[model samples]
Target chain A: MNLGLDRNTIYPATHMWRRFSYFFFAIFFCFAIAANLLAQDWIKSGTGLGVERIRIAVPEFKAANQDPRNSELLRTFNDTLWNDLTNAGIFEMVSKSFYPLGQIGAPSDVKFDTWGQTPVNAAMLVFGNLGASGNNVVVQGWLEDVKNPNSPPVLAKQYTDNATTQQARVIAHKFADEIIFRLGGGINGIAETQIYYVSTRSGHKEIWAMDYDGANQHPVTTLGTISLSPHVSPDGSRLAFSSFNGSAWEIRMFSFDLNRMVSFPRYGRTNLSPSWAPDGTRLAFSSSRSGTPEIYAVDQSGGNLHRLTNSGTTNVSPTWNRKTGSEIAWVSRHGDLPKIFTMSADGTNVQQLTDQGYAVSPSWSPNGQFLVFSWMRHYGPGAPGSQDIYLMDVTNKQWVQLTHDGGRNDFPCWSPDNRHIVFQSNRSGSLQIWSMLADGSNQKQLTTSGTNSEPDWSWK
Target chain B: MKQSQSRWIALVFALGAILFLGACHKKAAPAPPPPPPPPPTPTATLTANPETIDKGQSTTLTWQTSNATDISIEGVGAVQPNGTQQVTPTESTTYTLTAKGAGGTQTATARVTVNAPPPPPPPPPPSLTEEQLFAQNVKDVYFDYDKSDVRADQQSLVQADAAFLQQHPNMSVTIEGHCDERGSTEYNLALGDNRASAVKNALVAAGVPADRVKTVSFGKEKPFCTESNEACWQQNRRGHFVLNK
Candidate 1:
């Protein structure tokens, strides 16, 4: 055969080359379509589910001791943690009755697959020893996440408490927050905060401080006078409270560490609700200094004074938005019923945030997006005292009732992350500090020893 | 010369071929030139009767013309006390009246000064003498603790009360006494009574008639709400006077 081909043969070869190019183009087009489909699948798998609903199994916490009394106390802890976690809304709880997994302990020995058998995405096993250590009951708890039977479970947390059996609910709240953090986001565990409130101990009503779960309780003022509306300073080192000693109801400052108390100047005949500024250098409180209870901001050293409200109404319980330092929410009696009002820090552009029945004691969320306050509905005469905790979204001015069917729930203090709220309630037969999820669920009592009320959450 | 001619012919043919190709290509359709951008309609600059007009007044307006053959003025109102106005102009007027133009519209307003009607006349002054004035102004006298007898510390406050009673002979004064938040409520009530009686005795001793000084006891029921301190408590435990003409 001749090595060089003729023109007719060349023409046939060019036609074949054109056909091969078309075939390659078709292949490329199919590949492009396939690659796009694959890319979409990958993106969907990565970010399609914004947040997975975490199903948590809280096996009824077992007490190290088999004593009936200790078992009862553990039952309270179990109930409180269950309620708190449910209220948090971050967990889809598996009922202990249907836990399916046979008694998992917190030593990381639990089979993960056994827990995964149930609809539970994760399992929280609280195993701890509880007893009296000196004057307090020490509870050592360890939590574990049992998701897979084969893999080693993660040791979630260990908690130690010096509270009495009645105050064990607080320790349980601390453990609940730990489980929440292990799942994903950061939260304010009950162990890390405190509450400043007024209690009728020492034969008189005086300002007192206690752990968020109501464990370590002590009096802040010993003036033998009546103190009302005690507030924690933003730095969490001091407390500002209103006391009626001999002059007017003066706002007094007390150092938590030093245990020393000092009085602010008597600006009005009555002063109440001393709320600290976000910067911790000033206090926003309600004072009758201008002849009515209007909101006023004064420096920690009692220097620069600025009136934050001019409605001449009884504006009480002034709380500053933690994120936005320019706005404050307070209870104003400008209408028939006391409504929640928000105003600029400079006493301008006043706007009403709530038209609900008589709202009081507003506490701000850490993000400054919502405010938790006590809502009171007047019944037939005699100081209508049925109050419940309500959360109001500041941006949209919509309120979510957080406590329902509880007998007199009030004074809600938000956790630093806004996930949980600690409030006071008489639902447990006595007034005590209670912790619940911000969404009105899992109502767990925190205090049991004395009549504890007005629980203010500490900022860590 | 033949080669040169061939070169010129190639150059001309190549140029002609490029021109023909350019003409044949898709011409990019000129992107439709964005529809000529719909000639920017001029905004109407409204000129009111006065730059700063008072409440309840009207102003005259005017303006320039461009493409608009007819124009009208609308939305005219007065600025509120907080410096905001709501206007609703019906038809276009002129500089002396109100008018509109092609460049949009303009307004000029005649000063329609709306002075807030004069405040209601001040209420008639109270008809009281110096003595009555003293008694009315001196509302009460706050006292100290434990001692029913008037203390020297409360001498100045008692003197003010006595002076008022001396001036207003026609006015009868009722001394209402109160106690601090401490102690039993019943005990405080009696103590308040004693304190008011002591104040009445002091006024009598200072030349006011005993019949002129009546005493009442609010006791611990009423507190002046002093600071929760020793000094504030001392100020709260006292007697107050209510004068009736």
Candidate 2:
């Protein structure tokens, strides 16, 4: 048989070797190229899952006053808003060079195409008139969504009564929430909320109320007596607190609008930790009038006194879970650690929800699925001084640590949406109101004055 | 030549046969001894007594195990016999003993009773001292923040403190002013000082001599009760007298 160089014929050994080498080389080259493409595809698909990269353009804030240079208040407000939005994890803010519009409230109209050419998906225009109003500085501005310039921008107004140039940063935080609510799909604006806390600037414990961002702080009671446990009504209209009237601890009510005060029945004993019921018609408080510290419910008119707890183990801090209209949360000393216990408003079906350390001061979320409380672990002496805030899921019985580094953080109050909690801490070297996301991120200090504590966020 | 070629082919075939057999035998042979019996099976033994212990008291248990084994126990009286073992008892403690070497375990515990302790001796019958029985009852007196000057509203509380001081001329007392846990340590300290001074001044004005009373401000350092509410704060923000005979 003769083998020749025909169309599909095998040739001599030398030619066969050359052909085999070329075929092998082609196959190897294809495999290498395919592997590279496969790797690129996997990376793209992996990163494409809900991971969005967005750039933001924050214009320099223009002050309402015709000051030649930028005011420190304006600068602080601008910086705070920038930090809040960046920490919200929704935007990657672009540099100032990208936004040549100069300042936020600058007179020049925003050029949409200018922001569009850059990678910025949204441009925040925060231009406000900051001027003194009575004892406060009012900031009024509108946030425009440059992505869709034709759409109407949202209006945001913040008032910082008793504000110094430094406190303007807190007002800016309120404004930032407004912006987040409008654009970032969070909750309702927190600007109108109030915080009730105990202040001793007057040399005695006085119940004080301030805006959620620590503005417009004012004393609720002027009796010059000892006042503590200032609990805001569910609607944020009235404050139910305990005050010593030179005799015994009495539960008192202070109307925020009328500024009038009324004391509950002079029950020759100490009444403390008044928590307003969801219906706002009754208050649940711990009282020793029953011979021992027990939980009792009093009407808004201080009538119909009903005792809910008879366990006699110093059940204090009774907070009603508005979400579960029938459940009440409190701290029970019946256990070794003051653990969190939940019971029916009628005082049945008691369930212990936590077993981790000494937990106290339980504040339930509006949704009734979780409780935020202070967990303490005393290290050296006296009373186990180390304390931090922890969040527990009532349904799953899971706890997540909210503050780790804040020194002795306690008194955690949840925002209406349960997304953010306002707590008190000496982390910044002084007792101050600080806020963080529910999952323990974006922690920012809200107050800087002498010593502020026991901050209770308003439901409104 | 054809015959010689055939011979050479046979020889080559034989050599190939031998080599293939050798390769097959190598592949099928048993592996070398499996690394020296894998260090011996470390023994760990755990043992305890009474397996159950009562609450509030310490229970000791001994354990012996190989390979430096650690022991642990569980249940109401659950405790670590030593620092190495754990003890937890309130009511009905269960303990588990665990050790190494075949994963051995032996548990013994004593019953733990979480009953309340015996009551203390009763106090003497209530008796009023002659001074307390005859002391004038002053009702009220008030003062400003960090100021000892008597205010108009607190006439009743101050009157009582002063009346008590006046009636007991021979008895000395210490007045302590306290502030709530709300402000700076220094501020509260100063405020407490002012409160005590103000109360003393009021007592002196109400006809009581200043020598009978001493004043000190705890500031916010010491709170009668630690709570964030207004009631606890009210309790902390007051002046108390420690009367001495």
Candidate 3:
């Protein structure tokens, strides 16, 4: 090493050139490392700014056929698809009003440069065409990554169904679901689900079903007496609810396939708040059959009965942990007020989830990480709090109040995808069903004509 | 394109609304200051003819007042203040008269007493029919919202109902449990069931036959008071007794 350094020390010109080359190499290496690091997105968890929804674009599909009915299908499909994408909560949908005057709504017609401009600025695009054929409707859809020119589309799908308004809407929902599945990190979309609730529009309470977007409101039971707390099965074949049969309350199972009351067992005392397990094999409900209110489980056929809780102090509203299927979250009155509690399905390891106040209507999230419940922090004759909805992180017992003191909000149920909550509130003067995102944003009224309550979001 | 069209239409409609309102405002006279509130007037009156009477006989009561939007008696409900009404007292008792209006409220009392007892051989039966008497004997047992257990304060009512059931061995009573319009409807139904069962259990504990009592839960469907206030809700949540025919 000394001998090599002696030659460089004697040659000033060579030494200067070596120094310059070393400096240049060092600067280039730094830039290459920094550029690679800068290309990645920074992930954070400590602030509300962590949420970054993917931006997407959807344009009204072109009418593929000349039939007049084809116009109706196209319009319906477009509106429904827009609503589904907007409500997904994982997408930032671009406004159609921002689209360029030249509408290119097909795979062959797309000009990527126009969409990549300032007004559109879409990362993903959903384009499709719909037509009416005899008694069926046909749709062709393509979802493209506008930035990727090598292989343009990320998803391509086709759906065909009977040529009815309901079927047309369903096709749009399915296509949106497919796009969500492909780009939303495998989270299922809630577009094709239904919401069942109680409506008093007919002068008496009855079970009513509606689309997830509050479309297609129709009564499922015309029992003429009071019916409440409707829970649809996992497969969407039957609905279980409690109806006043001019006597006491009974669990009545109504078949959607038959559109009539199917035979279920008539238990003694009263049965209420029917909740379905993640699997459709059994149901968990509250019953006074044991001379006091307790949580009970029964098969879907109303056989093989077993009691889950014997708290003897109004144990009620038993909702299962849909993910584990081993634990149940319910309301139990162990102290001065009713509180939310979680217990093993066999009533073995009962643990109180709430420490104080009047809490009821505990609904486990689909992900099994949190629970949504109605709580009155200082509940009493002259308490200082109003009933509202709250979300609790089960692991840490950290709770976030969803609704303020607007009105008495209760009976909150989670949507299938765990992105939304449907509840009842008296905020609009009378009891009405309302919906909101899981974070308590985007509140919307679902029922206007009649008093609605006890909303149960459907399983997929 | 459709969204833009709607937005343009909305903008036009908003402008039209503003201009129409401006025109109306221009043509209209300045609104006069609100008229002074009407002077409040006090109301007070009371009279009873033949206050003393035999047991089981009724007395005529009349009163007049200057200003009253509503009037009521202690037992009898809403009545005209200047009108005469009849009241039947089973024994010596006092009747409270109240008159209410925007001004305020005034109350008065009158006494009615039985002059003498029957001639020792036979007692005077009440003027009320047996069915009506039984209806009065049946009292509603109250409960807390979503509670099926009998409260400490409401135990006396359940005991009295049990005694009434025992007095008429051949009678069957239906215990209807009701709830306030709060909480989930299905949960309330179960709570109502528990409430009725609790009342029935109380009666059975008090030596009343279990077979003579039947239970039903109306949940929140049948409410005694439709008002959405705390007092009304308290009245709505109860274990009511009805005699089955």
Candidate achieving the largest TM-score: 3
Cα lDDT tens digits, model 3, B1-245, are 54355445645654564476457645763655986576476486777778898877889888777577767766667778787888877766555666766555666667666555677874455433545767889788998765667999988888888888798887788899899976655556667777888899999999999999899888777888988788999998898888777
1 versus 2: better TM-score goes to: 2
State in Å the error of residue A100, model 2: 2.7
Q: Which stretches of candidate 3 lie over 4 Å from their true place?
A: A1-51, B1-130, B144-156
User: TM-score of predicted model 2?
Assistant: 0.54
Report the C-alpha lDDT of model 1 over B156-228, residue by residue, as the tens digit: 7777777766866776777777887543222344456557777888888888998787666555656777465
CAPRI docking class of candidate 3: acceptable
Model 2: residues with Cα > 4 Å off, grouped in runs: A1-55, A61-98, A101-108, A117-142, A149-178, A377-385, A428-430, B1-245
Range of the 10 consecutive residues with the lowest summed lDDT in candidate 3 chain B: B122-131
lDDT per residue, candidate 3, A261-281, as tens digits?
A: 999998877778888888888
Best by DockQ: 3
The C-alpha TM-scores of every prediction are: 0.52, 0.54, 0.73
- Relative to the true structure, candidate 1 reaches a TM of 0.52
The predicted structure with the larger DockQ, 2 or 3, is: 3
Best-fitting candidate, measured by lDDT? 3
lDDT of 1 by residue, A1-460 (tens): 2211123322234543333233222211112222321222111111111133355666665555545566666777777777666655555566666656355444554555666564544544444455544445556655554543343444445555654555778777777777555543343444446777767767676777776555578877787866666778778888888767554557888886886976567674556678877888888887655444578898898878878777654457788888767888887764434678888888788898766455667889876767888876453236544677876667666554566665777778887656568887877777677887555555677667667766777776
**Candidate 3 TM-score restricted to chain A:** 0.86
**What local lDDT score does residue A300 receive in model 1, on the 0 to 100 scale?**
90
